[model samples]
Target: MKSFLTILFFVAITAFSTDTVQSQTFPKMDTSPMDLAMARPDRNTPPIARVIYSRPQKNGREIFGELVPYGKVWRTGANEATELTIYEPLKVNETVLQPGTYTLYTIPEEDMWTVIINKNANVWGTVYKKENDIVRLETPARNAAAPAESLSMVFRPENNGATLMIGWDKTYVEVPFEKVK
Candidate 1:
């Protein structure tokens, strides 16, 4: 009878542990589709940065107008949203940014675009309030070198830091913020 009880206890422990492990390893429900609503979706590769998201990129064909439409707040990628993150102090245009992470926001238009550096983080894309935003600046549209068939936010390598370039259609705009000492 003692041996029988010991066997039962072991079986119960193993089952409970297995259940716990399975729950922990269960696949996380995809939130990238909901994350990149405002930004144009990249067809080839999802535009959302991978490191920023805990899950695999939310990517699919026909995501732009069909899934993610124009003229909205984009999380910048999969996960909570694309955080306008910064580690060191940064200077956008004339404004000074202290050490902090911020939500990068944008207001798109036909001729030009309004890109903003908000103080708010941990927001679901633009779902949170915009009042916490520190600075909102507009960048003039730049002519694309060639027609880009994708919605891409490319950070071109620079000798110092790099230029953050946002491109869609034929019009593009750039914000060059150098790393501060």
Candidate 2:
């Protein structure tokens, strides 16, 4: 029965090796991945504003007013706090924000959304303090004709500035800002 014992030993060793390898390997599923979007004034010019955030997929789930909830401060994105960098000073809804990096947070509501730019940056999750907020502007929330499966932020260049558009599911909000002279 030496051959039988040898076969059993080989199977045991193989199973143990497989278990060890699997345990040491990273997880195959990545729930949320980091994403970057930027806005440039001109084709040849450098980006005036940049946003870094993690895109969370819908996954056939109800996003707004449910998963994200309403009237609560959201991190604005997944993983690390959503970050925004401005290369130049800009006026966001008549409030002048200096050229620097800031963390973006939002309070989503059924009718309106409050966009907050805080001094805190590179934070984890929805840990926000009102004392750190630089500006809080309420913007209109519009309904999208089609649903968005993934969260997205876009900058639409206007006459002398750009509008930051944040969209998810079937809702979106736009924050218009002007470049200060």
Candidate 3:
């Protein structure tokens, strides 16, 4: 009877261990990792703006106007909400946003896209609050030369500011922001 009890205990322990491992073994399926930063031309200055997001692949499927519909809030990327960290106060279009982290969201349209900076940095999927929006600016949407297999956000440095370029599939948009004096 003691041997039988020991065998049962070992079986239970193995089962629990297996369950724990399985729970933690979930894969990062999206795969496209993106990190973009805008820094001063001087080497001494640290990055003034940074963004981290997971990129989802096209996989031969329709993206803009279909997978991502128009006039709806998009999380801007896959997995955890796309995060933007600004170390200095900047003017996005005409709206001023203070230095802080924000979740980037967007509404895609054929002619234009509305880029949103939201106060909530910890959100998943398309869950967003309009009340939490810090600023929203509309930018022109244009066709890309070639289809981008994966989503991408790049920061193009300028003399006084930067342009945030977002591209996926065949569509792209640019948002300009400048440091506040």
Q: Cα lDDT of all candidates, in order?
A: 0.58, 0.91, 0.86
- Residue-wise C-alpha lDDT for candidate 1, range 1-181, written one tens digit per residue: 9999999999999999999988888577654333222111234632222113222232444433334455665554445655655545656776767766677766665556777777777776457467776776777767788855445565654544456776654657777665555
Candidate 3 lDDT, 1-181, residue by residue in tens: 9999999999999999999999998677546565555545456877778888878889888998888888899998888889998888889978888888999999999999999999998778878999998889999999999989989888888888788889999999998879888
Give residue 136's error in model 3 in angstroms: 0.8
Global local distance difference test of model 2: 0.91
Clashes per model (N, Cα, C within 3 A): 2, 0, 0
RMSD of 3: 4.6
Error of 3 at 47 (Å): 0.7
The sequence of per-residue lDDT tens digits that candidate 2 reaches over residues 1-181 is 9999999999999999999998998877668888888888879988888889999999999898899999999998899999999988889877888889999999999889999999998899988999998989999999988888889999998888889999999999998878898
Cα displacement (angstroms), candidate 2, residue 89, comes to 0.6
Preferred candidate (lDDT higher): 1 or 2: 2
Task: Note the residue pairs that clash in candidate 1.
Answer: 48-77, 75-82
Clashing pairs in 3: none
Candidate 1 ranges with C-alpha deviation above 4 Å? 1-79, 143-150, 169-171
* TM-score of each model, in listed order: 0.55, 0.84, 0.80
| TM-score leader | 2
- As a whole number from 0 to 100, the lDDT of residue 18 in candidate 1 is 98
Q: Give residue 7's error in model 3 in angstroms.
A: 25
What TM-score does candidate 1 get on C-alpha atoms? 0.55
